[model samples]
Target: MKIYSKLTSLFIVVVLLGTLSMRPSEKKILIFFETKGYYHESIPTGVAAIQLMGQQNGFAVDTSRTSEIFTDEKLSIYDAVLFMSTTKDVLNEEEQNAFKRFIQKGKGFVGIHAATDTEYEWPWFNQLVGAYFKSHPKQQDAVLHIKDSKHPATKHLPKTWKRWDEWYNFKDIQPDLKVLITLDESSYTGGENGSNHPISWYHSFDGGRAFYTGLGHTHEAYSDPLFLKHVLGGINYAMGKK
Candidate 1:
């Protein structure tokens, strides 16, 4: 009887260990949409699209508009942080410090359109975003030139993709960035960056990965398969999955 009890206990331990070993690691993302300046009307559509992507891709997403979730304990729970069209100064000094620490700990960051328009006073934040939104022409159709076809973000896109959105002219463009897409100034008027205008880029910053795209300004962009693929690739790249 004692031998039987011991055998049962050992079986239970083995089963528990097997279950633990078979469990997959969870991937979680935080989508922060706080805007202090001009808010995009497409913000809700963007959030919903991202949530759907997360659901389909087997990752978890949490949305927040408040800076209170920027603490170390809170930020630590997410594998990646995405700024879904966030603008202006959104975090206080303490929260900013916590976010800096979070990035330094090797997490990921994904920024959509107008994220570059944020935190002009914080140099570190600007550097992480890769560029600042200098100005933009009216929303119009433009040709996107794929610079890096091998990049996950541009792999599925054509060499010359045509899309319409609020086209931004960036200032303080990071010289070391791996640009994935550039805009052909000839295809659109009011382009201020001349011929070598970059529209999407990614790079490793500090101790973390950062990806930004000057896309997703219009509600229709979220539903476009190619655009969705582009955003998904950025998200995957930021999460270190691509």
Candidate 2:
């Protein structure tokens, strides 16, 4: 009986140590860049930046550049989905359905730059992005107005930030979206109509978290510490992390 009790205690210790050792790993993020529009030059840069950020932030990162995004099973495996400068109608009906289902599952999404230029025909994607790319005046220096400084993505940013990129105008944005930053048309050369332009914002749609940023016009921008932090914070938040 004494020997049996000692062996039983040893087995329990081994089982507990194995259970603790086998905790699930950190979540992974997959970035897709199927660009066919104005910001093609920035896609590779954006993907590279995301890869670096994943390493810095301790998350596994993978990437693909296919318009045929049709894996419902694979979509469920990722913590976040990042659309990097994809323009034009890429996904077919089945793929769109898969994407919709992916968001419906309460995952996260991050849209960078020309992601606004994509899925103009898909109203769901337009709202998910919080805006669509209408047109840009020209690529030049412009000042970004930080609207809500309390947002995790913009909390560390300055009130009036100047960056060089193509500014996008959106159509019929929902009033419910909490706009994080707007363009200072006065400080910029274009944006003549001065409609409410949302450069960065977050929203909960279809039971999932979404984040979009319209600032990635150049690859260099992604490497900048502040810009990287903005993207990282948005990505992390969408992944349900603080």
Candidate 3:
């Protein structure tokens, strides 16, 4: 009996040590860039950029250009869904319903650049993105007016950021979104939205969180440290992090 009791105690100690050494599960995000309309040439670059961000920030990242991954089974592993320049109607009705359910279950979403150009008929998507793409002139240098500078996504940004990229005009702008940054129309041209052109925003939708930024359109954007931080901040925000 004494020998048996000693062996049992040793086994329990080993088990406890093993359990204590186990690492916590990593947070995962899916970067979906399916475009049923115009595809951006910078999609690959953007994917690499986001994957690097995940690596440095201690999160798992997956990329998919197909809408077939929208099933509940596949999406179950992800804490958030990021649309990196997805354009037009990429998801069918069934997939759309599944995505809606995913967000409704308290998942998160992050949109980038031309993500606002997607899903014009989907009201839920419009509200989630805060706007729909309308038009823009040629790419040129412009100043960004930081509206809410305290947001994790915009806090590092300059009060008046000057950069050259393809700017976009928007339609169906939702009032519920917390605008983070706006374009200073007078700094450049193609001033469609005039004094109220919001380029970045975030808001809570349904039971989930959503963040969108319209600042990453060029290949150079993926390499910019500030722009990368902006994207990372938005991603973290959507995932309910800082």
Candidate 4:
């Protein structure tokens, strides 16, 4: 009777261990916000959208202040990093090196709105962002032309969608960027003579996927259902889900 009892106890322990080990772990994504920016409201709204998407897709979302986080070790703990409308020069030398290494290590990154206006002094970061902010024609209602519909980020979006946001002109765009969406010159004022003003794009640089969208300039933009879906797709695509 003693031997039988001991065997039953061992079997139960083994089964319990197996069940615990079989449970899936949640994926985590980190969001870094540069709080020293003009468009503060938009960033928080964007973060909320990201959190909603994370919950829907079984991901754990983490957020940090720009001046407090962004160490190499802290960054490694996440599968993806988001630069949410940050416009300040918040990163020091050590942080920049860490960030560069982070991308080289094959992770994911997303840049929204004013992210292009940041890190202008850092040449490598400028290239990573795909373009630097030159100027905006004006704050006007614009139409975003889906240049690459097959791309996971823009795939679900309509061919031409109307949105109200601050359109930006970027300077010294890197040649290798895979342009995803452009602003339709006909729908807005203030673009240079060229018709193709890239508003959103994604590229793999330094062994990691990087995505940037020039939308999200206003809180209203983030609340829009269609805009939220677009942002969600971009985040998932960057994380290799879409």
Candidate 4: misplaced stretches above 4 Å? 1-24, 37-39
Tens digit of per-residue lDDT, candidate 1, span 1-242: 99999999999999999999998777889999999999999999999999999999988999999989999999998988999999999999999999999999989999999999999999999889999999998999999999999988889999999999999999988887999999999999999999899999999998999999999999999999999999999998888884
Supply the global lDDT for candidate 2: 0.83
Please say which candidate is ahead in lDDT: 2 or 3: 3
Q: After superposition, how far is residue 35 of candidate 3 from its true place, in Å?
A: 1.2
- Estimate, for each residue in 18-58, the C-alpha lDDT of model 3 and write its tens digit: 99889667789999999988889999999999998899999
Writing each residue's lDDT as its tens digit, candidate 2 over 15-56 gives 999998897668788898875655478778788888988887
lDDT of 1 at 177: 91
For candidate 4, write residues 1-242 as lDDT tens digits.
Answer: 99999999999999999999998666688888865546566677778888887898788899876545667878878777888888858688898888888888888888988888888789998888899888886688988888898887788889988888888888988888898889888888887527878889999999888999988888888678787777777777677663
TM-score per candidate:
0.93, 0.89, 0.92, 0.89
After superposing candidate 3, which stretches have Cα over 4 Å from the reference? Answer: 1-24
Query: Lowest lDDT 10-mer window, candidate 2?
Result: 189-198
Top of the candidates by lDDT: 1
Greater TM-score among 2 and 3 belongs to 3
Q: Return the number of clashes found in candidate 1.
A: 0
Itemize residue pairs with steric clashes in candidate 2.
none
